[model samples]
Target: MFLAWQEIKKNKLRFTLITGILMLVSYLVFFLSGLATGLASLNREAVDKWQASAIILTDESDKSLYQSSMSIEQLNDIKAKKTAVIGQLNAIASNDDDKQNISLFGINKEEFLMPNVTQGRAFEKANEVIADESLKDKGFKLGDTLSLSSSDQQLTIVGFTDHARFNAAPVLYANLATFHQVKFGEAADQKKDQINGIVVRDDSISKLTQNDELDSIEIESFIQSLPGYTEQKLTLNFMIYFLFGISSIIVAIFLYVLTVQKISMFGVMKAQGISSTYLSWSVVAQTFILAFIGTTLGFAFTLVSGAFLPAAVPVSFDLTLMMFYGLILMVVATAGAVFSVLTIVRIDPLKAIGG
Candidate 1:
């Protein structure tokens, strides 16, 4: 510990430069991680709310909610502890000329999947709607009326819920009857009680899917199958993995070269009866200190940057995930320093000291 601190104190400039580089790398990795997490949440936010075990849809739809159609007959045949009918539609929610793309979810308010209202009362009448808090960014307000482009009926925002979104659009919760009316118009009777999917909580979900034309899939599988979700997550994760590799290489090469520079010093120390284990400890100590300082600086910068980041940028900052990332970085850094320790261990005292 003393040797490591002495070396760092003596050569402040080199260590400081290395720390700065590490800090920059950590910042990039953390920010990218946040973006990936945020985008994923946006993709599956509403479904995540269900906390259900399985979802039922027709296999013919190929896991697409928009294409899947389940009639009243199919819903009646299923048994569950609790179930919710969900009708999904893509439409423009317009307040006069102001328009925003939205995924309107028509839900049975009485069902277990119904979102809890945070700002106002739940929807109790036809044409009444509840929006995710995200819609507030688009100029929507409580009591604001938004017209679905396809329907003559106007939707009045009666409530707002937290963290409800699907496929990157703010969700609008409406009654199943109103949704049928908005989607199918006066001929809505033709599509009455039709639902895209059913979220069910049951222990016997596997048995429930034994029937042909109905399949029950885990919630995670359903989320991953959504368009662009898996692809985006893969691309972002690739970058994070690449950064981890780069961090390992940078720490290894830099420490290895620094150890090489101190070869003669190590030789003299060995000649003076110092142990290889102590010398190796010094090397690891330096690497750990560098990692600790760099990660702390990077974390601080990320926190400050949050205030400056725009709302449009989707970023999820999970403390547990970030801590895990930091821990991995430190471990990689320590592992990189092992090469330096080995170099010191192999040094011959007599040759190094030129006795």
Candidate 2:
């Protein structure tokens, strides 16, 4: 191990160059991982806030919530203690100077799915709306008024909630009556109540089985059907895994060339009574030291960038996921060292030293 450190110190330029490349690759991986996680959060945060075991969507919509419609009477057929009838739609909400796309959610304030308000108070009336905190970026604040383009109505921003985005758009929580009026243009006397779906409690799964018109899929499965959610996740995951494969190849090629360059030196060391096992262990230790330093630097950059980045760029990296990624990097780097160890093992001390 001492000899390996000594060699790295002596070959400072070569090692430094390789280390810089490793650092950049790792930084790319970490940044992309955070972005992917943040995007998925935008898709699922609203439903995830409910913590429901399953969601019931009408079978007629072909497993799509946006296309499914259920009447209030049909929703009453579900026996869950915490059933929440939900309606989702997309519309543009504009203030005097700005307009932003929003995913509107109609939820009963008393239901379990209502997110906790971060500012002001929750909506309790037909014309009031609670918005995701993300809207603060678009010049909205509590007590502000927003007009929806699809209806001749104005909604007061009563409150703001955190982490309530849906399908990459800020979510607006409104009363069921307001949603019906804005979505269907139906008057109160018409009695045409419709909802996208219902989220049910975990223990009520058996009770819901009796209904054949609704299909109970896990909340995650329902989220997967959201537009662009599944496709974006798959594309990001493929890039992350591809980056991992590139790291392995990069480390392996660098170490193999370094090993080949030092074949004669290894042979001389073996002829001078140095053990092959010690040489192999040193190779692994070198790999660990370099990989550890490089990945640590990359994550440091991620943290610093998070601090300075504007609020709009989502950076929600889970600790467990980051730890798993670091582990994978170290393992692949160590595996690359094994090739150098093989080269050391094959050194012919007698032939090389002219014995």
Candidate 3:
């Protein structure tokens, strides 16, 4: 460690440049990781809030909530200790010239799916709605009237709920009757009560028999089935993996070049009886020290960047996930130093010193 420190001190400019490169790469990785997490949350935040074990959907819906529909009589056929009937629709809410796409969820106020209002009170009357707090960014507010596109029905925003978004859009929660009216308009009374799916507890979900008409899907699977959810995560993860590989290559090339440049110095030391094992270990120690400094600075930069990012930008930092990735980076960096260590071990004292 002492010898490694001495070498770095002697070539401060070179080592500093290498450290800077590593820091930048690490920073990019962490930033992208946070963005990935934030985007994933937007895709499934509302469903996660339900905390249900599984959801019961029509077998023919292919695990997609949008395609599933069940009559009230079918809902009664299934039994569970905890259950909630839910309706879902993609709708545009407009206020004057301002418009935003939203996921309208039809839920009974008394059911477990009803999100607790964070601001104002839950809806108490027909046509009253509770919306995700994110809608505020689009100029929506409590008491604002939102007109449904293509329909005469209008809704009043009575409250705001935190962390209730779906498919990267704000969610609007309305009573079941109100949703039926908004969905069917004049035909609401003519059609029977129908819901998109049912939320059920994990243990209680087993009570459901393998009926030909209904299928039970785990909550995680349901989230994965959301449109673009899996594809988005796969794309971001591929980028992150590529960065990790690049980080390893950068460290290896820098260390190997530095070791090559110091071959004569190492040969002189070996001639004076310094062991090859000690010199090889010193190269590894330097790699670890440089990687530690770079990754630490990079993580700090990520935190600062996250702080300044606009709320409109979806980026969420998870300390545990970041730490895990950082550890993996450090390991890969140490592995990258293997070539430098081998070069140090193979130095011929007589040939190098004579040259």
Please report the candidate that would top lDDT against the real structure: 3
- All candidates' lDDT scores? 0.88, 0.83, 0.90
The residue-by-residue lDDT of candidate 1 on 52-140, one tens digit each, is 88888888988888888888568776777777778889988899647888998888888887899999889999999989998888788
TM-score of each: 0.94, 0.94, 0.97
Q: Which is superior by lDDT, 1 or 3?
A: 3
Q: Write one digit per residue (lDDT tens) for candidate 2, span 1-355.
A: 7977888899989888777767887888888889899889988887787888888888888777788887777776777767888888889999887899998888787888788999999887888999999899899988888888888778899999998887778999998888877787746447347788888886657557457888888777788988888899899888988888787788888988998888888889999899999999998888877888788888788778877877778777776787688778777877878778898998898866667
Off by over 4 Å in 2: 186-188, 204-207
Segments in model 1 whose C-alpha atoms lie over 4 Å from true places? none
| Error at 181, model 1, angstroms | 1.7
Which TM-score value belongs to model 1?
0.94
What clash pairs does model 2 have?
none
Q: Candidate 2, which ten residues in sequence have the lowest lDDT sum?
A: 184-193
Q: lDDT by residue for model 3 over 26-89, one digit each (tens)?
A: 8988998999999999999999999999999999999988899888667676777788889988
